[model samples]
Target: MGRTVRVKSFELVAKDINDVDVKLLHALSIGVGWPHRPKDWDFLRRAGHGIVAVDGIGRVFGSAMWFPYGHEFATIGLVITSPRTQAQGTGRWLMEQVFERCGDRNLTLNSTHAAYHLYLSLGFTKEATVYQWQGEAVSPPPPVPALTAELSSLSTANIGEIAALDERAFGANRQKLLALLSEGAAISVLRRGGEAVGFSMKREFGRGHVIGPIVASNDCDAIHLTAVHLRDLAGQFVRVDTREQTGPFADFLQQSRLGINDTVSTMSKGKRFLNRKENEPWVYGLAGHALS
Candidate 1:
């Protein structure tokens, strides 16, 4: 006679993120209070490569993903571990797996408060703070400073027009990511002397819409670039993640009713990630915490 026996423990192995059902990944994010939907997970799968920690029966317990901009750099994100597995080194194990796969590439990530110490132990240095501003968009937004540049709609076919400027601000050639984000997104470009000086994109993400990757040389231009999109999304749930703490740009967002929701620390390994110059083009708003 034989009877089934229950096991008290099980081992987990790394599996390709794409190999699992999208719902599983969605559930994994939701388990940790993250707002990623199935669609969002699918989009992330297309945007980069990732891995999930799963047991023999395919029950996922943790996940880690990396978005590579080039041979020398990549952004790590979506690192999540089930609550039951916390304090057991699952998070660090998943990170080590990502490190192995990433090789010697320089890495950057927006670390939540809970994971800050872990990252510091891994040799990541603090760079900046990313504030997540989100709420119901105001119809008129707020009054902006006088316009100094011509604002115009930019077609996806002409994405190359802003590639150089974006590279200058982001410190990487991520035109590929920009093209993927431009799919079904509302894109606007700021021009002076017939040259593209700044640009922004509003796209569907998370609970509602996100206006981000706002690139500009100063606060005023950033305000105008953001206001143009807020004007169209009035009364809808909108979100923007930015590193600007205090300035005309931050004030404009506060007046627009998008209050600060949460913040994450931007950390980097191998090289300094953020370099703000006096008047050079800067990333006023990030595409997403994960994508940053």
Candidate 2:
């Protein structure tokens, strides 16, 4: 069963979002001057699902998303509250709406400074800090044959393997999201001995391009795959949210001239075990804080 409510003089309804709601969410993202494109919103909703708050006039004012991977893991993200409706309890209401549908699965979200305490009150503890590296990209040196010799462009045929790899790294199934994000974007895959092992993508976003969701067996492989795509994005503004644990990877981005732009906190309510291989750091860069 679904629940409904009324806030102030406006009759508010909380329900699953449709394409129309996504457009409204996109407007909110742009109103806040965030970098997410409308297409990105589509990707998230299409990949998993979300709940939205709509007023009497059918204007969507708030939204929260969750991605479920089987019965084990899920990521809660893309949370946005309209500036006009801030501090009015709409945010909390929207969060509750999402929680009701989350069931007993573990939940994760990357929090902005403003919403940290709210999440804390909800029992989401801090996991690790993530940093955003952004700036004009530089021309990367030619790929070392030993490294990129096996790297190739990604296509529809690669989605399954990529999603399986992502599950091992992200602990979630985000095939739909990856496919939409990779559409028309520069996607590179690394193969060793004819076996797919790593991948990276660069997409037009925010002020320019962003490289992210880069998953590889290790930092070296991650860097190589990302570098293969970075060379083509040279002199363009790019953003990547690097995990704090990967200090060397973050430093390499800085040395490559991507300045540390900002930071966000990755928090979770339940234990989502990302039991991964030791040598495989998996994700050297994220798609974005909103989606992570």
Candidate 3:
């Protein structure tokens, strides 16, 4: 019989809030073909929990990130394994560490085809199927009267306001995450008569761009913001994730002929603490590929 592989005894290092290792983590994530940015690390570190697997020789074998919105709701992402250590259970082990650390929280993750089975085995069931419309021309959206609201870019000056709006849109207080986004990613806010109404953010990736967390006060605003952001992409391809619940926006995507490229099932396990409103416009995109 073949020899059984012995589980490696690795130390799980929880990164210090706003630690510099975030840069290294971002690099590693990108190396694994994930769409991420150095600035994203700041957001993940502040708005989420991270665990790094360190071997006896002080080498990092794998890492996982969990972004929490409140006491019991979190979106997990950035699960990466060193190329040399793939299939060694490093990814699974890192996930176990995340579950152990955030057991009381309802977790969500957007798993790739290769990892979907692993996530399903962990009690995460399919909730919604996601699609990507890539390689299409980025056309400007028609002007809508309801979207005449003022648009603002997220910055340190307005992080609190941004966080409040985010909670209203996503149903949880993610102030720390806002702070991180302000630092690492580009965030745009839509305001009507100076009141925050919606927001969206984007992170750079090797392939192209992923737009998300496109939350708005109405369907029109969501479409306007998505069009504005997609227009900026111009020649490059863009990927957007729409939920089945956001009826209006989902309808818009369908009618616009932004055909589905691929889909992912949004699954969950454990009780969810945050009450997600069905009325809020569907999320046209998420903060990142991982968080979406």
Judging by TM-score against the true structure, name the best candidate: 1
Tens-digit lDDT track for model 1 on 1-292? 1111112387778889999999999899999998888988888888999998888898988899999999999999999988988777778888888898899999999999999999999999998999999999987777999999899999999999999999999999999989988886999999999999999999998899999899999999999999999999999999999998798999999999999999999999997888888799999999989998
Question: Per-residue lDDT tens digits of candidate 2, residues 1-292?
Answer: 3455566677678867764655688898887667777777776677778888887678888788887766766788878888877778777877888888888888888888888988999889897788888888777633332454487887865677678877677877778778777775788888777877888888877678788888887767877777777788788888888774455566567667888777888898889444557866377788877567
TM-scores for all predictions: 0.96, 0.88, 0.73
The Cα error of candidate 2 at residue 194, in Å, is 2.6
lDDT of each: 0.91, 0.76, 0.65
Q: Which residue pairs does candidate 2 place in steric collision?
A: none
Return the top candidate by lDDT: 1
Q: Least lDDT summed over 10 consecutive residues: which range in candidate 2?
A: 140-149
User: Which of candidates 1 and 2 is the stronger one according to TM-score?
Assistant: 1
Q: List, residue by residue over 126-197, the lDDT tens digit for candidate 3.
A: 766666654543455434345578776777677687676776666667677666655645678888788777
Backbone collisions counted per model: 0, 0, 5
Q: Which pairs clash in the backbone of model 3?
A: 127-266, 212-285, 212-286, 213-285, 213-286
Query: For every candidate structure, what is the RMSD over all alpha carbons to the true structure, in angstroms?
Result: 4.3, 2.7, 5.1
- Shift in Å, residue 196, candidate 1: 0.6
| lDDT-based ranking | 1, 2, 3
TM-score of structure candidate 3: 0.73
Q: What is the lDDT of residue 83 in candidate 1?
A: 90
Better of 2 and 3 by lDDT: 2
